[model samples]
Target: MDEFSFCDKSLSYEVRVKDLIDRMTLDEKAGQIGDTALGVPRIGLPKYEWWSEALHGVSDVGQAGNHVTHFDDVIPGATSFPTVILTSATFNQSLWKKIGQAVSTEARAMYNLGHAGLTFWSPNINVVRDPRWGRALETPGEDPFVAGRYAVNYVRGLQDVEGSTEDDEVADLDSRPLKVSACCKHYAAYDVDNWLGVDRYHFDAIVTEQDMMETFQRPFEMCVKEGDVSSVMCSYNKINGIPACADPRLLKDTIRGEWNLRGYIVSDCDSIDVMLDAQKWLNDEPYYCLDLDCGYYYPNYANTSVRMGKVKEAELDSALKNLYNVLMRLGFFDGSPKYEKLGKSDICSHENIELATEAARQGIVLLKNANQTLPLKSNKIKTIAVVGPHANATSAMIGNYAGVPCRFTSPIDGFSKYGKVKYETGCGEVFCKNESLIFPAVRAAKKADATVLVVGLDLTVEAESLDRTDLLLPGYQQQLIQQVSSQSKGPVILVIMSAGGVDISFAKDDPNIQSIIWAGYPGEEGGHAIADIVFGKANPGGRLPLTWFYTNYTDMLPLTSMRLRPIESLDYPGRTYKFYDGPTVYPFGFGLSYTNFTYKLVSSTKTVNVKLNKFQHCRDLNYTEGSYKPPCPAILIEDLKSSCGDYKVKLEIEVKNVGERDGSDVVMVYWSPPQGIAEAPIVDLVGFERVFVGGGGGSVKVGFELDVCKSLGLVDFRGYRLLPSGGGKFVIGDGVLSLPLQINFRR
Candidate 1:
C-alpha cells in the first residue's frame, strides 16, 4: 500500500478527489453510481446509499427506500412538517427556510445514526403547471418565478453553513458541519401525471423552444444559479423527442455547457434504464457516449458494461468528476471532526418541533370565511363537534412523503383544545363509506353548539402513482356534511385536510356551510395550528398557491394537453393562472385573512432609449451600400428591444391594514404587456413580496427594483427577451393598487 495525501484535510477538494479516484479500480467506479455503493475497504471508504429522502423530515426505508417513504409510519415521530404544497401556500420564503433548516438538521441526525444519507432528495421545485398532477402536492404551484424564489431560499436554508451566509441561518441544520444538500428535481418540464393513455414515466413532451426557454426551464435555471443546488435529477419524461436523462442539450449543453452548473445529474429512479429500453437510444450519439459512472447507474448493477467501446473514459471521468466534487465539498473524504459525534436526542429537538408548528400555522389556507364565520370566539361558542373520517385519523392528517409524526394531532384533538368538544369518525374508508357511522356523526353534529367537519382525500386516494378520476370528495363525507349542516343550530366550519384543490361546489352554494379551510395535510403540530386559527389565537394568513377550478373545466380540459400559453379559440382552456381566463372557485393568490389590506402605488420608473431615434441615427451614420455596413451596433438584432440588457425598473408601494384585525398580505405584482406586444401569457407574475401589516392602525412602505432587461422580459419565438419599451402597467395588491411604469433607456 502507498501513502496518499487524499487523507489530508489541508488539500483542495479537487486534489483530494483526483487522488481518491485514481486509487479506485474501474469496477469500483462503475459500482459507485447506484444508490448503494460497495466500499473499497483498502481505501477506508464505508458502504453507503444515495437513495435517502428528507422531503419534510428524514424518511428511512431499510433497503427499498422510496417504497415506504410516502406513508405515515409512526406516532410521536420525527416532528413531521407540513407537505411541500402546504409550505408553498404560505408564500413566506422565510418560513420555508426555517422549515428547511429543521429538516436538514434532522437529516444530519439521521445520517449520524446511520439511518440516512447526507445528500437529501428534497425541495421539489418543479413548477406546478397542471393542478391535476397527482404529485402537485410535491411541488410549488403554477408560476416558475415563485417556485424559483422558494427554491433559492429553501435551498440556502437546507445547505447552510453556520456562518457562511447570514440570510440562510435561522433554525438548526447543524452546529457547524455543512447541512444536507437539497436537490431541485425533475430537471426539465415535468408537471403532469398519468393521462391520455400515457403516463409521465414515458411521456414524450412536445414543447416549443420559446415556451421551453421562457416558461418551464426558468425555475431549474434559477435553482442552479440562485440556489447553487448540489444535485439535479432528470425527469422521467422526454423534453422534446429524447428522454431527459439522455438529452445532451439539457444535461451537457444547457446545464453543463451554458450554465456551467457544477452539480451532478442523477436519473430519476431507473430513468436511465428506460432510455436504453423504451427510447432505444443505446446506439445514439449522446446516449452512446453517456458516462455510466455519473450516477447514470443501471438498475441491474451491471458494472461489466464499462468495458464496452460505445463511450469514452474521458467522458465518464468528466461526469464522475462532477459527483466527486459535490462529495468532496461536503467533506466526506476529509473526515472532518465536526461530523464524528451524534445522538438520538437530535432527531426532534424542541426547536425543531417549534419550527414544525410554525410551518403548519403559516401553511393553513383559509379558503372561505363568509360573514366572519371563523375565529370562533371561546365565550360565544360553548360546544364544538369535530366529525369526519379525518377527525381522528393520523394517516389522513399527514399526507404522502411525510415523516413519522412526533405527535399526531387529529382534528378531534385540535377542536377539543377549547373544551366542550365532541368527536366522531363520519366514515370508514376514505374513498368509500360505512353506512352505520353517518347517523351517529350527524347526531353528534346536531347536538353540539357548532360543528367542525374535517374531511378530504388522503394518500390512498391520491399519491405517488395514484390518480383521481375527478376532483370531488372521495366518500359520503360530503353527504354527511350537508346533513349535519342542515341539522346543526349554529355555524358549520368545513375543514379540508388535503393537498391539491378539491371541487366543493356543494359547500360553496350551501349557505348553511359558513366557512372553508384548506388545512393541507399540516404536520404533527397541525392539530394545534388548526386549533389556533379556529379559536382566534392565530390569524390565518395563508393564500392559495394553486387555483381551484370548477368541475366543468375538468371535463373540458384534458390532462394530456401540454400547451402552456393560452389558445382562446376553444374558450382557452389553458393551463395555470397565467394563461387561463375562465372561472375559478378561488383564484391564484387568493386567501381570506382575519383582516384586510389596501395598497397604494407611490412611484415607478423604467429604462428607455434617451437618445432620440438612436437606432435610425446609428444606422444613418454607419450607412454603406444598400444596408448599413454591418448593421448599427446599438441596434442589436432585427429588434432593438432585444439589445437593452441594461433596462431597469423601480417602484415603491404603501400597504396598510385596512381591515379590523392585524395580518399579513402578499404584495403580488402582476404584469400585462402592451396589447399586440407578442405571444405570451396574459397578466403573468412579475414580482411578489409577503408584506406584514398591523391591524386597525398599522401601515408599512415596501420598495422593489429590478432590471427590466433580465428580470422582466418576453421571449419571442426565437428565444430573445423583448425588453419593455412602451409603457406598461404593474398591477399591485392583486387589484388594490395600480401604477404606471415610465421608461427611458440609457443606451
Candidate 2:
C-alpha cells in the first residue's frame, strides 16, 4: 500500500483523486455517498465504519482488551464532555477548537488500533427553540451568531487545514492531514426533531421568511461561509412541503449556490428511505418505487391514485453527488488498508484524563447565588445530603458520545472525601416513569445542613432522532425539588446535567434553593469537578446556551411544523427567541454567576463619526445623512458589508466586575428594527464577545458593524430590500436599547 497525505499536493493531488473516482464503479460511488454500517466488508473497499459519534468522544464503537465495543446502554467507564449546549455557554472558541482536535485525535487512535473511521455525527447546529423540545442540549443554544461562531471553530478543530502546519497534539499521522471531517447536521429549520419513532418523516414546519433567515437559516449560513464544514446531514423533517434531502432551494440554491459549500450531504441514516416509504403510505397520491433520483420506477399502490412523480431524479442526483464528492475528498476510494485491533493501551491516558478534568472545570455554569452561600469554609457543615438519581450514578456525569474513562467518580464518591455525606437516589436512571420517591428524598433533605440535588434528563430520554415527550424532568423530579425546598432544613444547591435544558421554575422562586448549576454532562471527571465547585476548589463560569420555557409542550411550535407548513406561512413561524414574541421562562444567552458584574452604556456616535471623518473628503459623494452608508473595502469581496455606517448605530459599552472575585462575562448584542421597517421579529442576535473581569473593574467596547446591518436584510416581506428602514439598538443585561442608534441610509 502507498502512503499519501491529502494535504501534500495540490491539483496535482487531484490527479490521484480523479484516478480513484474513475476506478470506482457506480455502486461504489453511490456507496461513497451513503456511509455503511459499522461492519460491512465490501471487496475492494475497506469495511464500512459508520458509527462515529462526536459530542465528547466518538460515540461509536471502541475496543477493550481484545474485544470490540458492543451496543450496550451502559459502558463501564466512559469519559463524558459537557453537552454541546452547555459547552456553548462557555463562549470559548479556543476550547471548542481543542475539543474538535482532541475528539478527532482519540478517534484516530482508535482507528489506527482497529476501530472504524465512521464517526457518530455531532455539533448539532440546530438553533434552540421551544425548550420543551427535549433535545436542546444537542444544540449550541438559541442564538444563530453564537451557534455560527462555535461551528467555525469546531470545524477547524475537527478538520485539518488543506495546507497548514502539523499540530503537535495529534501524534500519529502518515499522509492524512485532516484529523476528521466534522459534519454540520440537521441543516435548516430542524430545531425540535422531538416527535417519536418515524413520525418526523412527515412533520413539516412552516416558518416566516423573517424567522427562517433570522433564526434557523443564519446558523447554516455561518457553518457554510465561515466554518467550511466538510459534510452536512439533512434533517428528517421537511421545510415547507418538501423533504430536506430533496429540497432544491435549500440543498442546491442556498447551501451550494449562495453559500458556496463544497461538502458532501448525507441523509440522516435511512431518512431518505423513510420519507420514500412515507410518500408511499401517508400521502393519498399513487406510489412509485424509484431510486433516490426518482427514476426507473416500479408501481407499488395501483388502484386508487397512481401519480408517478413524487421525487425528481435531479433532486436525487444532487443529494447523491453532495455525499459522493465529500468521500472523494476524504480519500475513501484510495484502496487503503483497514485499521487493526485495539487494546486498553489505547484507553484513557494520564494526560488525556487531565485534559478531561480541566475541560469539566471550565464548562460548569453557576446560575444563581443569594448571599454568596458557596465555597463552604469550614468542615462544621457536616450533614450533607446528596439527593437525586444523578447524585450517585457514575454514568449521569457524562452525556452522550462518551469514551471509556480510566477513572469513574460519582458525586457520592467525590463529596465523601470531605466529611459525612448522605446519598439518596432522587429519581431513577434519568428516564424511568416512577415518581414515588419525592417524600423520602425531601425527608432526607430535612435532616441535612446543606443539600446538593443533582438532576436532569437521562441520555436515553433525549438525543438525536429522538424527541422528548415533555419539557420538565419526568416523574416527581420537579415536585421532588419543590417538596425538598419547602421542607429542607438547610440551603440547597441544584445541579443539572442533561443534553437539553431543564425547567428551573420550581427552584427559581424558591428562596431555599440558594444556587443553580448547569453541569451539562461533564465527562469522566464531572463529579470531581462538581465537588470542586461546591467546595470552592474551582469557580463556575458557564452560561446558558439556550432559552428556558415556563410551561408544557404545547406552548411552543412542534418540531414537525417545518415539514407541515406552507412556505409563505413560514416567515413568522416563531421558532427561536429571535422570532418568538411571547415571554419566556428564560431568555437565550441568559445565565447567572456567583459574583456580581455591572454593565454600563459608555459611549455612542463618537466612534462612527471618527471612522467617517477619514471618508469625508472622498469623491464618492457628499456625506449627507441620506447618502452616508458605509463603503466596503475592495479587498474584502464577500466580507465587505460586515460593518454599519449609519449614524443610528454608534454606541459604546463598558462592563465592570464589582465583586471581590475574578469572573468572566459574555456581552450579547441583540438588534431589532424600531417599527414598520419590514415587520421584523422581536430581536435578532448581532454580535457577542466574552471577556474576563478582575476584582476591581474592566471595560471593553462592543461595536455594531455594518455587515450586521446587511446580514439583517433577510426579512423583506414586501419583496424589495428596505433602503431606509428601522434602526438597530443594543441590549445590555435585561435592559433593551440602553444605547440606541439611528439609520442613515443612502439614496
Q: Name the TM-score of candidate 1.
A: 0.90
Model 1, 236-259: lDDT tens digits are 788777788777888888876676
**Which regions in candidate 1 have their CA more than 4 angstroms from the true location?**
61-76, 166-177, 282-306, 336-342, 568-572, 606-646, 743-747
> Judged by lDDT against the true structure, how good is candidate 1?
0.71
**Candidate 2 lDDT score relative to the true structure:** 0.60
Candidate 1, residue 476: Cα displacement in angstroms equals 2.4
lDDT of 2 by residue, 307-403 (tens): 2445443433444444434544455554223212333344465656666776676677777776787865447678788888799867656655565
* RMSD, one per candidate, in order: 5.4, 7.6
Alpha carbon lDDT at 212, candidate 1: 83
